[model samples]
Target: MDFYTVLSRYYDLVFQKNKKALSMIKHLVEIDDHTSLLDLGAGTGEEAIDLAFEGYHVIAADLNED
Candidate 1:
């Protein structure tokens, strides 16, 4: 298995979503009328998933395809 594949298995255990940052983003961006967002280098897609749940259309991109 590749390095990212191994890391992905344990990523969530070691890292959790940053609620403060997500709040900052919500304050900065207008999340209305089906707002769209592109998260480059999005790892594990935790934040993107959160934003999506909040009604924003999020597209997560990452280098590791694990």
Candidate 2:
């Protein structure tokens, strides 16, 4: 496996969502019918999940496909 593939497995253990960033994004976007966001390099998609939970359309992708 490659470095990112290995890192994907332990990503959640080593990192958690950045609450401040999440808040800032929400504050800036102000979810609406047309509101959408893309989270590139979104390892484990924790941030995307958070935004999605708040009813924002979010697309998350990562280099590591595992």
Put down candidate 2 lDDT per residue, 1-66, tens digits, no spaces: 788777777899888888999989988888889988999989889999989999999999987787
Q: Provide the lowest-lDDT 10-residue window in model 1.
A: 9-18
Supply candidate 2's per-residue lDDT for 42. 91
For candidate 2, give the lDDT: 0.90
C-alpha lDDT score of every prediction, in listed order: 0.89, 0.90
Error of 1 at 11 (Å): 0.7
The numbered model that scores best in lDDT is 2
Tens-digit per-residue lDDT, 17-53, candidate 1 = 8889899989999878868999997889999999998
Cα error of candidate 2 at position 9, Å: 1.3
- Candidate 1 has an lDDT of 0.89
